[model samples]
Target: MHDAPGLVAILAYDGLCTFEFGIAIEIFALPRPEFDFAWYRHSIVAVDRGPLRATGGFMVSADAGYEALTEARTIVIPGWRSRDELPPHALLDALRQAHERGARLLSICSGVFVLAAAGLLDGKRATTHWRYCDELARRFPAILVDPAVLYVDSGQVITSAGSAAGIDACLHLVERDFGAHVSNTVARRLVMAPLRAGGQAQFIAAPVAQVPRHDLAAVLEWARERLGETLTVPQMAAKALMSERTFLRRFKDATGMTPKAWLQHERMARARSLLETSALDTEQVAQRCGFASAESFRVAFRKAVGLAPSFYRERFGARQR
Candidate 1:
C-alpha cells in the first residue's frame, strides 16, 4: 500500500460526540483500496488518559495522550461536552503549539469550544451548531460567528455546524487536499451526496428562537407577503411604524439576521419552493423571487442553496407543474 502523506489525529475526550467522531473516522480512517492514492492515516488520541464516554452510549479507550496532538498534521476535535467546562491546560497548550507549527485544526459542532479556549479562534471567523451559535458568540466576542453556513474554513482553523455538517467539513478537507474527484469517490462510498446543496439555514426551523414582540411579528408577516416585491429596510420599518434605525435593530433581534440577510433568506425559501413546484425556468424563477437580474438570482441561490438553481430543481422538483 502506498503511504499516505500525513497523519490525522482525532482528539477524543470524555463525553465525546459519537456522530461527529464517527464522521471524522469515516472520512479519514476508513480504508479505501478502490483509490490508488494514499489516504490519511488515522490515530485516535485521548486528550486525557483512560476511557472516553461517547454520546452514543459507549466507552472507548485511546492508546495515546494529548502529546499526540503536537505531532499531528491535522487535529480533529469532535463535539465538546460542555462550553461551560474549560478544556484542560495541557490540551489547550498542545493545540496552541500544534497550530503555531502549522497544523490544521478542525472542530465539529461544540468542539469549537476547545479551540476557543485555546485562543485559536480569536479574531477568526468560525461557525458551530446553530443551537450554540448565540452562546459561542456571547462567550467569544472576538471570534466572528457565522451560524448560517455548514462550515467556515478560516485557512488553518475550520469549523462545522452540527451533526452531518462534520462530514461536509471532512469531505471539504479531502477536496482541498486531494481534489474534487477523490472527495467525490469517498462521498460515493459513504452513500452521501458528492456535494450537499444547502446550508444550516435550510435545516433551521426557527432562525430566531425568541418570540418576536407584537410589532416585530407584524413587520415580519408584512414582509413575508411581499417577497415578490423589492423590500427596503425603510419599507419594513414603515410597516411597523418605526424609524429605519429602530427597524434594523429590531429586525436583527426578531430574526437573528439583519433585514437584508433575512430578506434574502425569505426570497430564497420562496424561490426554492417555486423551483421545486413550478415549471418556470431560471429567469422566470428569478423574476418571481424579486431578484434584480437572473445573474444576481443565480449568485444568491448558489450561495444560499449550495448549488445552482438547475441542480436544485433537478434534485428536488416534484414533477414540475
Candidate 2:
C-alpha cells in the first residue's frame, strides 16, 4: 500500500466552477514553507484531456490528465457541473483503481454524483449540496444521503455539501493528513473560520422561522451570551415567554435541532474556540463551556472531534502563544 502524505490530484473537466476549484487549490496546492515536512504535490488533471470552458465564460486547462489520478495519494473531484451527466467510463475505472490502491477520495458538491455514478458511494453515507439531497437520494437509494450535515467522511471516501462547504471538507482532510495545528495554520492563511458550529440544516430555508420573532430571537441571543451557564429548556421557554412544550417544538422548527442538541453544539463550538485561542486548562475550559466536568468534556469532545480536549488544544492552540 502507498504511504500517506504524497501527491494530490484534483480532477477537472470541460465545465469548471471557480469557487470549489479555487478552494481545492487553496487547500491542497498552496506552498507551505511554514511546515518542516513536505506538503502535497498537487496537480490539476483533465478528465477529458482537453481545455475547459467554465460556467463564467472562462477557459482553463489541466496541468496533467487522468494518469495523475492513478498515482496520486489523494484524488479530489471538485464540484461537477451536472448530476445527470455521467463521467466517462475510463475516468470511473481510474477512480475505482485509485481507491483499490489506497488513494483517499473526496468529492465536493455535485461531484458526489460522479462518485455515485462510479458506484463508489453505493453503500456509503454521503452528502451533497442541500438543494440536490432529494435528487441524490432518489437516484441512489443505497447511499444514505445526510442532507443536514456539512460533510460526511466514510473513511475511504468523503463527500461535502455545496459550494463553500467544500472548504470545510478540504480543511478536514488537511487535519487528517497532518493535524489540527496544520489545518489551523492553513485556515489562518485563508482568513476564514477554521471550524464551523452548525450543520447544513441551519442554512436551509425554514419558512416559519425565516423572519425575526422578537421573543425567540431575544432568548437565542441571551443564551448565546451565556454559553457557560446551565441553560435549561424551561429557562429558555420562560425567557421567550412560551411554555416548555411550545418552546421545544418552536426551537426545533427554528434551528432544526432540539434545545439540548443546540446547547451541546454551542458548547462544542465554544470549547473549540477556547482550545484554539486560549491557554486554559482542560478543566477550566470545560467549566467555561458549561460541561459538567473535565471528564465529561473529554468524553463529549472525543465524541464530537475525535480528539481529547487537551490533545486538541496542544495541536490547535494559537501559534502566537
Candidate 3:
C-alpha cells in the first residue's frame, strides 16, 4: 500500500489572525477531489487551553492540543496573538522536539516570532511582514531577516511575509511536495497565479501612473503559445503594436516582473508540465521549452527547481508499471 502524504497541524490561539489562519486551512485542509493521490491530513492544534477566540469576534475549537504536534509531519503557525508575547514553554518545547525529529515548521506573518522564541530560527535567514522585519532582526540577532521578499524557504523551516503572502508560501510548500502540476491545481482553485517566485518583492511602490494595456492580454497569450520559438522583446513589442521602450515600461507596470523575467517564468512552467506529463527526453524537452541546448536547460532547471531534470522526472513524472 502507498503511504499517505504528511499530516499538517495548524495552530489556533486566542486573538488568532483570522485571515492568516484561514489561508492555512484553505490551502491544507480543503478536500482536493481533483487528484487521485492522498491529500494532506490536517488537525487544528490549540496553543491556548480551552476555547480560542480569534479576531473578528469568532471562536475556534481545536481538534487537538500541543501533544498532537508530536504526530504531525508539518506544523503551520498562523500569525501569533502578539509578537511581543512569547509562546508558552510547553508549546515551545513541542516545536523544538518536532524540529529535532525532522518535522517541517512554517510560519506566517508575526508567527515567525513563535519560531524565533523557540530558537529554531537561529542562524537561518527568515522573513516576516515588512513592518516587523526591523524588530525581528533586533530581537533575534542570529537570524538574517530579508525585508523585501515574499517568503524564505530554508529547507525544514519556511517563513512568509504578511497576510496574503502566506498563500504564496503554502502554495510553494505544495509545489515542493507534489510538483508544479499539483501546486497549479491548488492555485487554480484558489483563483490565484500558479506560482510567484519567492524572491518577488512583497510590496511594490506606487507607480507614477497606471498604464492601460487591454491589448497586452493578447500579446501574453501569444507569447505562451509560442514559447518554443526564439521570441524577442522587440517581437513581443511589435505584437503589442508598441515601441520596445514603451512595451518594457508598460509590461513591468502591468506585471510585477520585467518582460524577460516573465518569459523565463512561463518557459520554466511549461518545462515542468512537460517533465511531469510527457514522454520527451531531456534534449527534446529542452528544445520544446526554447532552451539554447540541453546543457543550458540543465543549468537553468537546476537553478530554478533545485533539482536536475532527470531527477525531477524520476521523482514526479507519470510512471508506467
Candidate 4:
C-alpha cells in the first residue's frame, strides 16, 4: 500500500441513493484479504441517526452523527434529495471543519449541491450530473461546472457526474492513495471495468434518430468483434449500408462519438483487458489488440487513459506466483 489506509466517513442523509451509498461501501468497506494490504475504516454517519428513508423507499440507520465528520480523513456525500433545499447548518459547519483540517471531500451526482451550499465549491472547477449542470451553474454563478467529463479532481475536492461515475471517482481515489495496481485489483474483484474511455458525452442522450436512418448499433456490435482487425469508417459504413456522411452523423447521434474515435476507444479497452488478465508481452498484446506495434499502442493508450500501458498492467495484472 502506498499510504496507510485512512478513515473514510460517508454522510448518510435522508433520501440518499442506496446505490450510491453502496458504491462507496463496496469500494472502501469491502474486505480484500487477497492483497494483505490495509483497507479504509468506513462509517455511515447520519446528519441525525434516526430512521432515514433512502432512495426507492429503503430504510437505513447511521452509527454516528455529524460529529463523525471531525475525525474522518476523507468525507463523501453520496447525494442530496433536492438541489434547492439547503443542507443543515450543523452539517455544513461540520463540513467546513473537516475542510479546515485538510480532509479530502467528494460528492456524487447532486451531492455537489450540498458542497456548493456550504460555499466550498465557489470559484472552483466542479461538476454534477449533466441534467443538472445548467441549474447548478445558474444557482452558483461563482462555481465553474464542466458537464463534459466523467469527474473532476481539484486537489482537495472531487466530484462525479452521475451514479456509476461515482465508481470512477472512487476508484481514482484508490489509485491516488495506494497505486494503480491496488485500484485495478479492487475493480476486478467488484467485476467492474477498470476504466471507461472518452467522456460523459458518450452516455448523454441526444435527439432521436430519423425514422429512415440506418441503425448504427449493429455496426458497433460488429466492430467490437473485429477490434483486432484493421477496421475503418468506410468499412463500418458499409456494414450499416449507409454512405459515410449519413453513417458518421447517425453513429455520433447514437453513440456520441465518431466512428474512428469509437474504434480507437474499443481497441484501447481491449488492450487494458489484455494487460490486466494476461501475461503476454506488450508486443504480443499489441498485436492481439490490432495495434501495429507496442510503440503505437503505447501512444494511443497513454493519450486515451493518461497512463502508460506497462504502468497500467503493473497495477491491474494478475500477480506472479
Best by the lDDT measure:
3
Tens-digit lDDT string for candidate 2 (1-321):
112478889887888877788889998988888876677899989887657887788887788878888789999998887788988999999999999999999999999998998899998899988999999999999999999988999998989998899999999998776655667789999998777655688788756656455456788779888988889888999998888887887787667688888788878878887887877899999999898899999999999888888777766666622
Alpha-carbon local distance difference test for all models: 0.82, 0.84, 0.89, 0.83
Error of 4 at 255 (Å): 2.0
Q: Record all residue pairs in model 2 with backbone atoms less than 3 Å apart, i.e. clashing.
A: none
Best by TM-score: 3
Which regions in candidate 2 have their CA more than 4 angstroms from the true location? 1-5, 32-38, 178-191, 205-211, 215-225, 237-254, 273-281, 310-321
Candidate 4 global CA lDDT score: 0.83
lDDT tens string, model 3, 32-74? 8888888899999999887799999999999899888999999
Cα lDDT tens digits for candidate 1, 1-321:
223549899988889888898999899988888866677887999876677888878997786787777678999998888889999998888899999999999999999999999999999999999999999999999999998888999889999999889999998888666544466678889999765544686577745637444467777778878887898887888888888887777666555578887777778767876876678998988988889899999999898667898877765555421
**Across residues 1-321, which tens digit of lDDT does each residue of candidate 4 receive?**
234668899988788888889999999888778766678998889975567898899888888887778889999999888888888999899998899889999899988999999999999999989999999999999999999877899889999999888999999898767655567778899898666655677678766655767766687789888887899888988888988888887787666667778788788777877887788988988888888988998998888777798887765565621
The superposed Cα distance between candidate 4 and the true structure at residue 276, in angstroms, equals 3.0
The Cα error of candidate 3 at residue 196, in Å, is 2.9
Model 4's number of clashes is 1
| TM-score for each model | 0.65, 0.82, 0.89, 0.77
User: Would you list the rank order by TM-score, best first?
Assistant: 3, 2, 4, 1
Ranking by lDDT: 3, 2, 4, 1
